[model samples]
Target: MAFSPLVDQLLDALRVLPGVGPKTAQRMAMHLLERDRDGGRQLARVLMQAAEDVGYCQRCRTLTEQPLCELCESPRREDRLLCIVESPGDMLAIEEAGGFRGRYFVLHGHLSPLDGIGPDDLGLDALDAVMEQAGVDEVILATNPTVEGEATAHYLAQQLKPRGVTLSRLAYGVPMGGELEYVDGGTLSRAFMGRQPFND
Candidate 1:
């Protein structure tokens, strides 16, 4: 089961990635060593470069090499509406969906007291500073629909309440093409609670 020490090290390193098990890591390491050393070299170079260069955007806390991210620097984005998300990936998903013209604040993570993460760790002070001076009118809670995400959003709402900005949470409901019967109970309940009146 053991190859060379370097190959074992490569497999272990590959396993550090999310969802990459021992077998997958072994296959990847083997493929790199046996098939495409050039591709592996390119991957290593790019990975090292990105790891060394990529840092948090000062304005939004999302991953960026610069002091601010492209979204934060965009003149066309709506400064009045601020969308708060839990991670850079979430921000990217919202951006890709389009139509939203607001700025974003990435928390990088959610509240989990058991894990020792709190408001300070999430950079709530920076967000508080933003709300105080950014002239923002609306703050959208776009955190994921989970216990931790909800707790983080609620904590943010409490903290930002004094700032006087209108706070809103993203709507949770059944998908447009999904049947109600197939929808889970929690989703159905949330949809029911957030239902709107029919128009004339």
Candidate 2:
């Protein structure tokens, strides 16, 4: 029995998402065909719309529909305190914990020289511009606990040290090599609360 081209194409497209293996993709294709035409159409429409409309914030580099993300646009947020995170999801996690009242800067990725990522690739220039324009007094490096995250944090610390802003790193409550998105809300909140100044 041969599967139709459309079915095979749907399965292949679904597999592009992380953790969606061939089996899961096939199952999803079958399920969409068997039980969910309206839902599938809505899903496709929303995915296309989001892909076309969502873009990175000019200030923080977080995904946003507007020129700047909500965090950057908010006037109530503490502009003097900035938290540097690897991705928008990490920013969301910290926001959800409700412990951080400061602004955020999303790097979009960690420094991984083996994978060809570098400081310039992570929008450090924009970050520097933001710091200069906003008169940021403190920068909290809230990147994940992974090796690359640590490396990125250290690199940023070194570069920004002479800029005269107080630099701090998130506390060690987050397990080593763990991602910010996967850590529990309590742990993330505690990490923010216990953050220490990075003198080096």
Candidate 3:
């Protein structure tokens, strides 16, 4: 026989997470029901609270429970250099990578006309307003290297270029430690195309 209605609902809910298939969801549901009901309840409570409370930062648009995220509130962050990322996760990745101490502005998603996403949806108007204010000297576009991302970057460039602020994009290529033989053709091609001159 199949799972009960509630169990099936739990499995379906679990499947909403990225990379979680039916089997994975079932396994998770089973583990929660059989082994750790308390943990599952705690997770549910916290998840509900976070889902209800979390909202975009007023300045950066990254998810936060407060009016401004920690990054935006931090006085230690550079005011003149701003990095634009497609998601909060992307911003986190760059933060974890270290070295760059600039501020960030998150665009929840790239521009997708077919999906009904537009510049307004991506917070371009807010960005324009932010750029209009003094202090931000440069903007680094850290959007993913996809078609939509490219289009978004190009659009931002066109909008921001006239403002006289320097604009830059993150370069894509092979991973630092990966061998060329194992690298994909597309990656290798980009690596070659983005090749930099070595200094003596």
On TM-score, the leading prediction is 1
Say which candidate scores most in lDDT. Answer: 1
**Per-residue CA lDDT of candidate 3, range 1-200, in tens?**
78999998899999989999999999999999999999999999999999999999988999999999999899898888989999999999999999888899999999999999988898887787667663889999888988999999998888888878899998889998889999999889999999999999
Computed on alpha carbons, the lDDT of every model, listed in order, comes to 0.91, 0.90, 0.91
Tens-place lDDT per residue, model 1, 1-200, is: 69988888999999989999999998999899999999999999999999999999888899998989988888998889999999999999998999899899999999999999988998787887777767899999999999999999999999888878899998898889999999999999989998999999
- C-alpha TM-score for every candidate: 0.95, 0.85, 0.92
Candidate 2 residues lying further than 4 Å off, grouped into runs, are 174-200
Worst ten in a row by lDDT for model 1: 125-134
- Checking candidate 3 for backbone clashes, the offending pairs are none
**Relative to the unseen true structure, what is the Cα RMSD of model 3?**
1.7
Q: How well does model 1 score by local distance difference test?
A: 0.91
Better model by lDDT: candidate 1 vs candidate 3: 1
- Output the worst ten-in-a-row residue range by lDDT, candidate 3: 125-134
